[model samples]
Target chain A: MALLKIRNLTVRFATSTGSFTAVDGIDTEVDRGEVLAIVGESGSGKSVSMLAVMGLLPDTATITADEMSYDGHDLLHMTKAERRQLIGREITMIFQEPIASLNPSFTVGFQIEEVLRLNLGMSRRDAHARALELFRQVGIPLPEEKLTSYPHQMSGGQCQRVMIAMAIASKPRLLIADEPTTALDVTIQKQILDLLMDLQEEYGMALILITHDMGVVAETADRVVVQYQGKKMEEADVLSLFEAPKHPYTRALLSALPENATGDRLPTVSDFFGEAVR
Target chain B: MSVVLEGRNITQDYHIGGGLFGASKTVQALKGVSFSVEKGKTLAIVGESGSGKSTLARIIALIDAPSGGDLLIEGQPVNIALKRPDPVLRSKVQMVFQNPYGSLNPRQKIGSVLMEPLVINRPAIAAEERRALAEAMLVRVGLGPEHFNRFPHMFSGGQRQRIAIARALMLNPSLLVLDEPVSALDLSVQAQVLNLLADLQEEFGLTYVFVSHDLSVVRYIADDVMVISQGLAVEQGKREAVFANPTDAYTRQLFAATPVTDVEAIRARVAKRQAAREAAGAPR
Candidate 1:
């Protein structure tokens, strides 16, 4: 069964001037123990849709959809208290920029511990113990010593690992990692991706891996969704998506990437994402 | 110099005091770094963070001077460290920074940013002339004159980067120090920007000193590639030579780290790693 399903989900933000739809009608699903990717440019609304799913959108936002379900529950009509209860327990999210997302004032341990205590009803001592375990599980060095260190003291890669550790600490059924390794160096990016894959296998949790990197999608995703200008451009199995992308945007994205074997110039598509597709 | 820019045995160091109550501690940011780009070719300085790529670019762009070296611009020894930059020399080289979002002032329009460089460097030029030059520069960078009135935030990331490039080119610089020019843009947008750069280089006959972390992007645009690690130049050669036959272990490691987009190739890689680990752990 699918863990989360969205049908014709559209979202808009009410700015001072007026309201503009950030995410046009787009439908996607995440099945159990599978990885699904939503690939797009920066403002394509991939992140916005997922943020809506996690019930973390701003107060000036408006969401309208035909259907939205999470763990067989109607997500659109859920109360704020119920949505808060579901967050960090049944569904968790890890953001793109680790340093910006992580709280600077608190220690990494305290941050993860609060998630445990609030969501799982664990005591302070118990949460700390679990936080250390999570730190080690994510391959962070010297879990005990790092418990007292703030987010600023850690490297980008290390801070990302801490974010992952915190997200998975509560053992959520669905984990959404939004461009987790986008800013990291190539080697460090590889290490973090591998760690996430390994953890996914161990935990058997559904993953919604959002990224613009087709290389990462090839390595991790079973299913893929392509978005252009807040619309669903294409959706297909991973093999089909790479082998024969039906949409022009998908084909252009594939051709633009300079592989180890590609020649000097990368072929570019003009105004590729300016058009809307469904 | 036959080369437009050259650095001879460049080294930079910082001193930190009171290590172990009396000893002086030192940190070397650059160690014997040396390379240069010709008048109209691109040289890529590739490395991870703290690899001294930025430091090297700064030194060459005359933003900062080296501690121990001779910097020759057009065969003339420039003691930039000892004195303020020569106005003519300063106008000859420009740098395009990494963050297009942060590089421009939020309050100013695109026209003002481009005009600022002109007015500050060429104070004798009239305001109308500077504004016209700014508009022309916008057209040169693939942006229209209509864009001159827009703010930096009004443009897309890639467009903002183009504006950044246009601003750098306004002075008609001989060399452009591009520090991660397209790193912040999307893949397709990155391709478009890179192609625009190649076209601009050929048309303007401009020398490019490109600093980037992505090796693939470097390979796509650079005529030559220099690999840096921990503030040291590890390898330098023609791009094809370096990519075809990487001699250094670090270069090979970096090549291996770049993820292959092919699914079968990645699976084969993961399988190979698993087999190697299994073979190593096998007991008699």
Candidate 2:
């Protein structure tokens, strides 16, 4: 059975000038233990759709859908208390910037333990023990010492590992990582990616990985959904998407990358649009 | 080919955690970094974050002085640490940063922003002529005249970066130091900006010292490549030589970690998977 499903999902923001439709009607699904990558440039509504799923969008934004559900639960009509119960326990999210997302005032141990105490209803002693174990599971060095350190004391990569540890504390059935490694260096990015894959397999959790890098999609994704200007351009398995992209926009994005660039001039989407016009 | 910019054994040390009670320790950011860029050629410095690539760029651009080493521009030696670089040397080298929005002034119109550099550097040129040159430069970066009066907030990230490029080129510097200029743009826009940079480099005969974390971009744009790891230049050679046979372990690891899209191999794998699925009677 599909772990998560969305149909005709639409998101619109009330701007000063007028209403702006940020995400058009789009349909996607995530199977149990499968990795679904949402790939697109900025302002393409890749992040917006996922934000809508997590109920994280601001009040100004209006979200609607024909059908949106997770594991036989109707996500579109969940009550606030029910969502609060489900979010961190069954579904969790990790953002791109780890330092900004983590609270500066709180120690890493306190934060992870807080999640455990609130979501899982554990005692302080048990939560502290579990937090240490979680840190070790995330491959953080000197887990005990790191627990006492604040977000600012750790490096960017270590902070990201803490964020991962927090997200997986409850052993969520579904994890949504939005550009989880975009701010990290390439080598560190590989480490984080490997860690995520290992955890996903160990927990059998479905993952929704959002990013703009094709290289990341090639390396980690099982399936891909490409977005452009708030519209879905293509959706296929990773191999098929890379091998035979039907959309011209996807092809242009693939070709625009410097990896395959051999000629003096690269092929841009505007060139394709111009040719289409002609 | 004359050496437009040369650095011999450059070093930078940064002091950290100094307070009223605690003693400060010096962290060596760069150690004995040396390289030279020929006139009308691009030399790329590639490294991960905290590898001291930005420190090297600042030393070359004269934004920050190196703790040790000599800098030569156009065969003239200059002391970058103790004294201000001569106006001639200052005007000869300009820098374009990564963040387009933060680098530009949000309050000023794009036209005035481009004209300010010309007005300050070449005061003898009349206002009308300066406006003409600024407008010409605007067009040269692929922006239109209609965009001149708009503020930086009105433009997209890619467009703002183009404006930044225009501002950097206003002084007609012989050398440009671009630090991760296209890392923020979308893939298609990155291509457009890179192509524009290539065209401008040829037209102006500009020497470039490009610093980036992305090796593929370095491969495409750089004539020579230098790999920096932990404040040391591990490898330096022609682009083809370095990429073809990387001697450094860090360089080889960077190459392996970089994910390159190979459509043909993916297609064959997909075909094999389809065949196996068919044999198993699996649903599509």
Q: TM-score: which candidate is best?
A: 2
Off by over 4 Å in 2: A274-278, B264-284
What's the lDDT for candidate 1? Answer: 0.87
TM-score of chain B of 1: 0.90
Per candidate, native contacts kept equal 0.62, 0.70
Residues B191-216 of candidate 2 have per-residue lDDT tens digits of 99899999999999999999999988
Candidate 1, A1-278: lDDT as tens digits: 67899999999999989988889999998887667899998788999999999888998999999999988898999998988888888799998899998889999888889888988989999998899999999999999999899999999999999999989987888999999999798888989998998887678788999999888888877789999788998999787788788988898898898663265567776644455343
Instruction: Say which candidate scores most in DockQ.
Output: 2
lDDT for B57 (candidate 2): 92
